[model samples]
Target: MTSFQMPNSADQINLREWLDEQSRQLGFDGLRITDTHLGDASERLNQWLAEGRHGQMEYMARHAQLRSDPGLLVPGTVRVICVTMNYLSPVIDFDQEWQRLAEPTHAVVSMYARGRDYHKVMRNRLQEFALLIEKQIGSFGYRVFTDSAPLMEVELARKAGLGWRGKHTLLLNRESGSTFFLGEILVDVPLPIDQEEESHCGTCQSCIDICPTQAITAPYQLDARRCISYLTIENPDAIPVEFRRAIGNRVYGCDDCQLICPWNKFAQRTALPDFAERHGLGRASLLQLWSWTEDEFEKRHEGSAIRRIGYQRWRRNLAVAMGNALADEAVSEVDKDELREVLRNALPTSDEMVVEHIEWALDS
Candidate 1:
């Protein structure tokens, strides 16, 4: 870790400069300051929610005001210190990941969820960064947020110039791409704000074109209802039949958009081992993950983001993937038969949701 020395004159050592140094030492890739105003992002959010684009994530609609304005989220906030952390595991090769996604029997968990829960990782680091800022500048009013709060993290980060919002509606940078986690520190103290970055998406629509479910409705617009990530992780309802085949072998979240993005070629690997693959998630087979008992699922995913969905959702997602595998021409008839037999065996003991999905997969 690099040590940052504050200048002998306290006045000469700007808080932002000190914060930047501390952030680097703390393993954050990018940091920028922005004001409380969220501008048109608030209106766009309202429109999206009004259209029911958030799907079953009702919490998004509940905190509209707080999410749009940092001042409202954290009273007396004058600046937002947005931070970005690249989480692309060095162990992963994009080409290999896409190849694995193609395999009917392989379980494709999203890259970001392969390790520790980012909510915990980012929050802990942000809290530490905040405390460090206070030690340097004396007592200060602030709040740290990862994805835990009803905050518009990507919008805040975009405004802060950590990166620009990609067409897939994720933060993208020339150096780190969209394979990063975003966090924010809403502060009362005014700080030097960064200029917003210009969008570099240009004419490329690979993210939109490559979506298995066509979740990206248009350039810069996403319909979360059709998103595989939302279908597998957020929506507690039955996996929509329309998207079952497209869901393929993705047992958790989907990364097709990010994986398809040209900018992702430049995505940086994570500095923290916290983002490394665990429980062989990056290469686990669908049958392997599906065979875990509820207790085993709980024990294995104790510190992982995938655990949040619970064993029931986990089973439901895997069942959907298995169904897709059954229908895939790439999978042999013998493999399909085995998958069908597995689904049938689980039907007698599975929950109503899981049973329905299992039956669907078997029939698919």
Candidate 2:
């Protein structure tokens, strides 16, 4: 880690104000600072892991201790500058999303995944922000992180006054709602810290009530094994049959919880173009996405986070959605036949996992 002299308290206050201005100019929606300690969030993480609620995401457990203490993750780190970037593009319509969910033939990719990969976008901006800080105060001991690290980011952001944790376990802001990405910079400087936001959720279980899979077992408690996002994106194996019907037409992720939250009505559109929809993903039909060849999937999602799931899992998720569409009474016989024919055509060539899912779809 590079070291630099700390500014005096008066200069530090001025630097903090400068950071806020510069962060907004760089397209970050919100910025706040907090110390390295995670407090009780660490204990909750351990208990969640012990119960195996993390499902197959082994990295969460592997780096448990490091996640609780940022200083351990990056030695000498004292203050963490947390930033938020709203990812909800202006073109997205909540009502249209609900309509798409009702349309069994349509594929509902999560709004976040429709655009450029957030990891790359957030990571690049965070690096640039850190560089600006370095230039302002000379070389400093710092490390940038987006979702790339195992650290408790939501908790850090919550502690930094970015937002309060909702029942769905996502950070929710009064102004921006929960439609944003979080990034952090761990620095050696003891910057002025922000106060934590009080939970505004008060008796509101809308997120839990609206979950298709009951993944939010209780307020602030999620069973990842039952989450559609985890099932489609994180779990690498064949998705459990129990959650297949509940998964509906969601091929990438389910946004039902966020959609149901009253706070999300205030969700702000992103100021950056990185989150703009790509490849007509927001309006694609199940058949349209199903028709994508493996090469086409790779090429179309070249710079997308969706590409990381690989062709197999992508096909598996599509198969599940297609199956749900097949079973939907709303779909006409003609469309069902077409869907069945498509599944039959792919059966001869798909891998073992995809073939099983395809057979299940055909059964529907």
Model 2 regions lying over 4 Å from their true place: 1-9
Cα deviation of 86, candidate 1, in Å: 1.1
CA RMSD (A), model 1: 3.4
Clashing pairs in 1: none
Instruction: Estimate, for each residue in 138-197, the C-alpha lDDT of model 2 and write its tens digit.
Output: 778888999998789999999999999998999999998999999999999877899999
Q: What's the lDDT for residue 30 in model 2?
A: 96
- On TM-score, the candidate that comes out on top is 2
TM-score for model 1? Answer: 0.95
Residue-wise C-alpha lDDT for candidate 1, range 16-114, written one tens digit per residue: 577778999998999988987888999999999999999989999999988988788778888899998888888999999989987889999999999
Candidate 2: worst-modelled 10 consecutive residues by lDDT = 1-10
Question: Candidates' lDDT values, in order?
Answer: 0.88, 0.94
